[model samples]
Target: MGAGDDAGKSFVTSGFTGTGGASAQPPSPSPPVAPGKVEGPLKSITPTEISKRHILSKIKRGTPSDVKNTVILPHVDAEADLAAIKNNQGKWLGGNKYEVNGRIWGLEGSGAIYPVRGDGLVEMNKLQYEALKGLITHEGDRDAMAKDKRFSRYKFHTTDEDWNVAQGVYDQR
Candidate 1:
């Protein structure tokens, strides 16, 4: 064909060979994904969810620096503590308190005794757990936490199951 004739001819490449064709070949298939997992467009997330996730992610295991004012005690036996709280089998420490693995945990309505480590690993009743999650759902934003001068510095803890359940409840609400 003449040089001028090639001007209107649109060529499509096929794979790595770079062979020109009238139409492009079908794209290669993607690798397999894990079981029971879908890879596609993500569900829309709200700003509140994002903020809550960010704040929750920031919380680390163990007590925060300023533990004097908070009820979360230094972790002695986290697993045991969690189990004790879950089973309610800890030794009574008086004043509506329980002790397990050297950690003193308080009952649900005994003042501000949130028996949780910094990373959201909590050992409390359903009501107290919900209330704690509600706080995270509300003021869980980094900017908001920073801006609010009186915001509590204590990073409370919650279990994975609890977090997911709480998030689901919040989503429903």
Candidate 2:
């Protein structure tokens, strides 16, 4: 083609141009998600359900009988102790009243008194237990705990036995 012939030809571009050609419109805003509703391929799960599944999966993996015999029983026992402390809140010594050795004690209820030490190993009474529970159990507490190294294992290994058993399992793994 000659140079003059090229001047009569117009060039076409792939996208929008300011010369009055069609332009792409912004995508319409998606409707806001309702409070509990979720979208996309991923599904939301509750922490309780996740914990249940984790326990179930561990059990399903079939530990050596010796490990189960030795480790499982002690873990269960410690769990029972924790449950007792949690359920019988009355047994806790400090009910906004008593403080001993810089720690609150639950004096009233009848159960083996697991004392809360400065190291955060256990709670002396229900009140202390509840306070610790409040710290790690809620989002606010979890966030605050994440910032401090002292509270790293505050939620786990509350009892010496539980801590030992957890350590054993961890070491074995």
Candidate 3:
């Protein structure tokens, strides 16, 4: 039957279903949380962040590099204030598009939030279709990145067929 059917002794259907008139005790209260020493409004940009969308020069691999450096309408209303993301995706060893994003993270101990502009790049490799897919992997994890001051000059090399590694430049202000 339902709960607390003590061999049909008492037809109790409420919470106090004691076998021989014994009441159940409620659970104890939880411990109080410790006070936090440091508080943060931590903000990290993800694909959901759609922060700043810009159309950089999509220079196709050709003789004079067909550059589209002008006439780009900034979608900052739905985006942010980044005019461009210094793209370093040039002609790849394979026939694919590599994307690098220069992002600036706030120094943890510092109270600054200005845009220092650091770019990270990832190759689509004719395979993956996301812009920043292999960026951190191509570059390095956050710790490896933090320890190595040369993150600005960091470059990733993979023999992935559709993934074209670039020999261009990144802009991390």
Candidate 4:
């Protein structure tokens, strides 16, 4: 069709030869599936972390409800990044680059955040973890959160067997 072709309900040629329909063709390349493992206990985020968030919340603005986290584990040169972070700080600038979805979102305030390093997923678990931390007012809230729809689908890999038990109904015949 020409550029003038009006938008409509449509499909694609997919560039595959002799297709009876789109159904018979293989889907695009995909990430490999990870092997399954037995579930583990509901690992607590820690009492101290909850307290920290509570204090920070009183002083800071954003609440748990207002945020959704995306963990970005750093996947690059630890030493060089740390040096960059330090150099950036000496000059007063942005932090080291952390790759997420293959893009490096640099830090805004500081030059470097060299706490954790090497083959790790930088910032990946941070925001969500902090949000979870902010939500832990007491023990019971944690229990309710297990059944929380917003968080249930995102079963922490740490919560092995418990996650399976909690998630079992959907898979049943």
Candidate 5:
């Protein structure tokens, strides 16, 4: 054959022959390594995974009565609940009212109203606050909350602050 004949043909051979040698061909893929034998018997492990989106990281744990408080609720809409309290739609467990960042907010006993910027309260950064604000005003979220059983106790747009306020209210009681 002519020199040009090998141009399109592979002269790849095995071993370190020199130009146009076996090394020209791609190396064969090595077989996957088998997993090493596990030492001892496999232990039963419990999974502790939870969704960061749904669960509030700032939820309160301890109660005032020296017990574990688990009645924390997510913050769905503080404005709506506060409005409800003002409109006499819901009872306001009023106690101390606070003006934080020029906004009046408080946590009521029994979690009647979510508190703002206080102990056991979820502190919101600007981004989190804005995100929650959008979520709280979503029409779909409102509709779901009205009809969904899950939303009956907790709103669809809950935040860590909401959970913390609920716990704080429970703690106050």
Candidate 6:
């Protein structure tokens, strides 16, 4: 009937406009094509997968014999040190004595004391002894030794004077 009415009627018939009109037609289908050649999928890769792929590429390029350079560390004689520790296992000095089980042992400067058990020894620094003095008593009992809870498993019973000496040694350090 008018220019505005014609424009509205044309818009309703056009497929671009979503109005439900009988004149609206579906879009034409696109031409079919083969999938393109690609090295991999478009999805993201994990760090571990990337690292493994990189390592595999390197291996494919060359073997270990093809390596031009390498580094090696100097060797050390650990057996001698271990032998020394084993030899000094149950040795202690005579200044202060602790009786573990039944045998008495003296505290020594070597930082180790033999327990009355005779089979093994406790190794510790002067600072460790000072810290454990409250937990240990002059009588080395299995319960006291077990309860001491110092980093070192070795425990012994010694006098207050010996403990004071140990503390002094720690202070000097």
Query: lDDT of each prediction vs. the true structure?
Result: 0.32, 0.27, 0.22, 0.27, 0.30, 0.26
lDDT of 4 by residue, 26-121 (tens): 323333322342111101111011111212122122334223222212122233333322222122222334432222333423222322211222
- Residues 65-133, candidate 5: write the lDDT tens digits: 111112112332233334433333332223344332222343333333333432223343332333333
lDDT of 4: 0.27
Give the higher-TM-score candidate: 3 or 6. 6
TM-score of each: 0.25, 0.16, 0.15, 0.24, 0.17, 0.15
Better of 2 and 5 by lDDT: 5
lDDT of 3 at 93: 19
Per-residue lDDT for 1-173 in model 2, tens only?
Answer: 11112333221111212222111223233343334422211122111111111121132222222211211111122233333333332232323222223323222233323222211122122222222323423323446644555445454534443333233222221
Q: What is candidate 5's local distance difference test score?
A: 0.30
Off by over 4 Å in 3: 1-126, 129-132, 137-159, 165-173
Over 4 Å off, model 6: 1-147, 151-156
- Candidate 3 residues 1-173, lDDT tens each? 21122343322122221222111223233233223321222222211222121222222212121111111111111112121111111111121211223233222223222222222212122211111122323352334432443332222432232122221111110
lDDT at residue 102 of model 3 (Cα atoms): 28
Give the residue spans of candidate 1 off by over 4 A. Answer: 1-68, 71-79, 110-113, 116-173
RMSD of 4: 19.9
Q: How many backbone clashes does candidate 3 have?
A: 16
Least accurate stretch of 10 residues (summed lDDT) in model 6? 67-76
Error of 6 at 151 (Å): 7.3
Best by TM-score: 1
Candidate 6 residue pairs that clash: none
Q: Between the candidate structures 1 and 2, which one is better when assessed by TM-score?
A: 1
Q: C-alpha displacement of 111 in model 5, angstroms?
A: 11
Kindly report which residue pairs in candidate 1 clash with one another: 120-157, 120-158, 121-157, 121-158
Q: Rank the candidates by TM-score, best first.
A: 1, 4, 5, 2, 6, 3
- Candidate 3 C-alpha error for residue 74, in Å: 16
